[model samples]
Target: MIRHLVLFKLGEGVERDDPRVLEGVDAFRSLDGKIPEIRFWELGWNFSDRPIAYDFAINSGFDDADALRRYLEHPEHQAGVTLWKEFSTWVIADYEY
Candidate 1:
């Protein structure tokens, strides 16, 4: 199995309550049921006040690297990424367990 992790930091001056951000969040949350390559998906806003913490996170699992790649290339996932690109930057990691 593979674990794919992502941490997002909102762009400067961007707020969580912004309409675009909300839509982006919904888009990601919706991916669970829409993408077959995604065996597991969990996303949420960060509640931490720590300076080093990211604003959002996505923790997902897949069968393998190819499954992970498919999920990344899926249209629904790409659309969510496009929305997030307008207001945030993120880092990701993937590893097998």
Candidate 2:
């Protein structure tokens, strides 16, 4: 399986409840039931106030790289990206297990 992890940091001065962030959150949370390629999906807000804490995270798994590619290209995921791109920046890692 392919583990796809992502850590997201909110843009400077952006708040967790900001409309854009809320939309992004909703979009990601909806993917679990909408996308078949996603074998696993976990997404949520971060309550940590520490300076090092990212604002959000996405922990997901796919059957393989092809399935991962399908998730990345899925329209639901793309819509989430649009909202997230406006209010956050993220880093991702993909590994096999």
Candidate 3:
């Protein structure tokens, strides 16, 4: 199994309290059952003061590299990525274990 983790920083002028932020959160949370290759999905919004912490984080599980590749190329995921790009400034990742 492989765990795909991503952390996102919102773009300039994008507030944490913005409604679009919640919409993005919901969109990611909804992908678990909809994407067959996604074994599990979890999302989080940071409310702490950590200097390096991102605004949001997503943790997804896949059965193998092929499953992960499929999830990455899925049409629904592409749409989600498009939506995310609008408000996201930076993205970081960890794709092992």
State which candidate has the highest lDDT: 1
lDDT string for model 2 (11-90, tens) is 99999889888888898998998999999998888889898988899999999999999999998899899889998899
Per-residue alpha-carbon lDDT of model 3 for 1-97, expressed as tens digits?
8888888999889987788877777777788789999887888887878888788888888988889999989988877787788889656453667
lDDT of 1 by residue, 1-97 (tens): 9999999999999999999999999999999979998888898989999999999999999999999989999999999999999999999999999
Residue 16 shift from truth in candidate 1, angstroms: 0.5
Q: Is candidate 1 or candidate 2 better by lDDT?
A: 1
TM-score of candidate 1 to 2 decimals: 0.97
Residue pairs that clash (backbone atoms under 3 angstroms), model 2: none
Tell me each candidate's TM-score: 0.97, 0.95, 0.87
Candidate 1 residue pairs in clash (backbone atoms < 3 Å): none
Runs with alpha carbons beyond 4 Å of true place in candidate 3: none
The positional error of residue 93 in candidate 2, measured at the CA in angstroms, is 0.6
Ranking by lDDT: 1, 2, 3
